[model samples]
Target: MKLYTWLSAPNPRRALIFVAEKAIDIDIEEASDPDNPGQLSKRYCEKYPHRRVPLLELDDGDWIAEAAAVCKYLEALYPDNPLFGRNAKEAALIEMWDRLAEWEGLMAVSEVFRNTHRLFVGRGLAGYDIQIPQISELAERGKLRLGRFFNKIDERLDQNEYLAGDIFSFADITALCAIDFSLSRKLIIPENCCNVKRWYQAVSERPSAIG
Candidate 1:
């Protein structure tokens, strides 16, 4: 399998952490910049219709998009050192929060990045610039939720080293990436969020985090 990636994207970082955690060695291909028109060129778009990075191209020629799905596939492939949950209840809870973290947490953070970030210059067009009244309202609500999310995760981590359970699941990596991205993209919890800050430090120190 070959994984297409980008250097600085948070979405790809999700897969990066997963593969690193599992110590899975797969062929890596760097995707051309999304900002560059070449991304949508015939060759790349054929390999990945979404025209996004972090694509997993299976040897059979099937392509897997989305970071979570890629993580799930990797977890299934290498179960000795697991990242997803182990059992039924564990799986449900872990996936639930993972979905929430990706949807509510990461999505909102990404909006702040793509829309508010200056690097998006020519890219932040129609879909990127469009304002949803709900997200705008939620952006305010998200500020409070961000605190709650941090507080909840921090409290959880206080008891166990990882989020979801004693194990370090993808949820931890997802939350970690989201929180780190928030520093540059959206409203970050100030240093006063002691537990959150402490938890982030731990996550940051992980060897996989460098990926």
Candidate 2:
């Protein structure tokens, strides 16, 4: 199997972290130029029309696009580390928290970055060539949503060691990536969010995080 990824982006970082934690030995290929955010090579665009990174290509020629899906596939193949979960209940909890992290945390950061960054002036959305105008209102709304997300996660983290539970799972990976990605927009965990700060420090120090 081969992993097509862009290391500079948060989405691919999720997969890379998973790979490091699992110690998977799959071949990796760069799908995008790190300096150029959304510009995909003609060959890459032709092969994967979605034009997204962190894609997993199976030896059989099947491709998995989303970051979560890519991690899921790797987890299935390399189940020893088990980042998803060990049981049905754990799986459900991990899934719920992972979705929340993606929808509430990562998407919020993306909204602000895509709508306000000059680099994305004519391309407000991903995986498309159509010119979508940036909306200042959306960026403002995203900041509000991001603030709420940080508070919610801090509350949750106060009661649990990781996002899903006592164990470190894929949910934590998503949340960590989202939190780090927000830095580009000058968004950060509030000084009073002590729980989140502690959680972030622990996760960021992990060896896999360097991936």
Candidate 3:
């Protein structure tokens, strides 16, 4: 199997972290930057029409595009270090928290960065052809929503060691990537969020986090 990914991208980082946690070895291919029209080679465009990174190509020639789906596929293949969940109820809870982290946390941070950053002036959303104009009002709203999301995560971590519970599952990985991505936009985790800070420190020290 071969994984197509970009080292600096948040989505690919999530997949890399998952692969690291599982201690699996897979060939990796870095995708060229789509931002540079000259560098957007025809071969890459034909292989990945959506122009998204962190895509997993199976040995049988099947391709998995989304980050969550790629992680799920890895989990299913390597059940020894199960990150999704062990049972039905645990799976549901993990999925719920994962979705919350992606929609509330990751999407919020992306909204602010993409809309306000000059690099994305003509291309705000990902995996789509339509170009959306920057909206300062939406950027402000995104910042506010991100603050609330951080507070919610801090509150959750205050009671539990991890997002779903005691175990460090895929939800924690999702939150970790999202929180780290916010730092690039100068959205530091508040000092008052001690629980979140503590949790982050622990997760950051893990070997998989380095991936």
Candidate 4:
């Protein structure tokens, strides 16, 4: 198996965290994509039609795209670690919160970072090129939504060590990547989220967080 990875991107970081937690070893190929050639290239698109980073090219010539799907495949292949959960119902709960974090939390951050950050003008996954300055109003609008989700997550964390289940799961990994990515954009946890702060500290202390 081979992983197409990007160190600075949250989506690929999600898979990296999972591989670390599960202790799975797979060959990694860094796809720079600076010239937009990586995505538009016929070679990569033949196996991965979408041509996104974080794609897994299996030895059998099957292509698995998307961060969540790649992680899910890894979890299934390595069942002892059980990041997704032990059973269907337990897995569903983790999936519920994980999806929420990905959509409401990570997506909003990506919108701001991709459109507003000058560094991503042509280097982004969408293969977009050109200078696009930060739109304070647009970014703040997304920030408000992210703020609400963060508060809700903080409240939930106050009641449990993990987000969806008793054990560390996918939701924890996804949320952690999102929080860590905030360092690039200077997004900090608000002062009033005591519970969230506590949870973040705990996650920071984990050995896998050394990345």
Which has the greatest lDDT?
2
- TM-score against native, each model: 0.81, 0.95, 0.93, 0.86
lDDT of 1 by residue, 60-155 (tens): 989888888987987788887877777999888788878777766667676555544444545432222233333345445556656666766666
Quantify all predictions' global Cα lDDT against the true fold. 0.72, 0.89, 0.85, 0.77
Between the candidate structures 2 and 4, which one is better when assessed by lDDT?
A: 2
Q: On residues 85-140, what C-alpha lDDT tens digit does candidate 4 reach at each position?
A: 88889899999989998887887787667657666554433532333455656567
Please report how far candidate 4 places residue 8 from its true position, in Å.
1.7
Which lDDT tens digits does candidate 3 get at residues 36-124?
Answer: 64233446658888777679988898899888999899888888888899999888889999999989988898889888887788767
* Model 4 spans > 4 angstroms off: 34-47, 122-137
Q: Return the lDDT, model 3, position 156.
A: 95
Relative to the true structure, candidate 4 reaches a TM of: 0.86
lDDT of 2 at 113: 90
lDDT of 4: 0.77
**What C-alpha lDDT, on a 0 to 100 scale, does residue 56 get in candidate 2?**
91
Model number with the top TM-score: 2
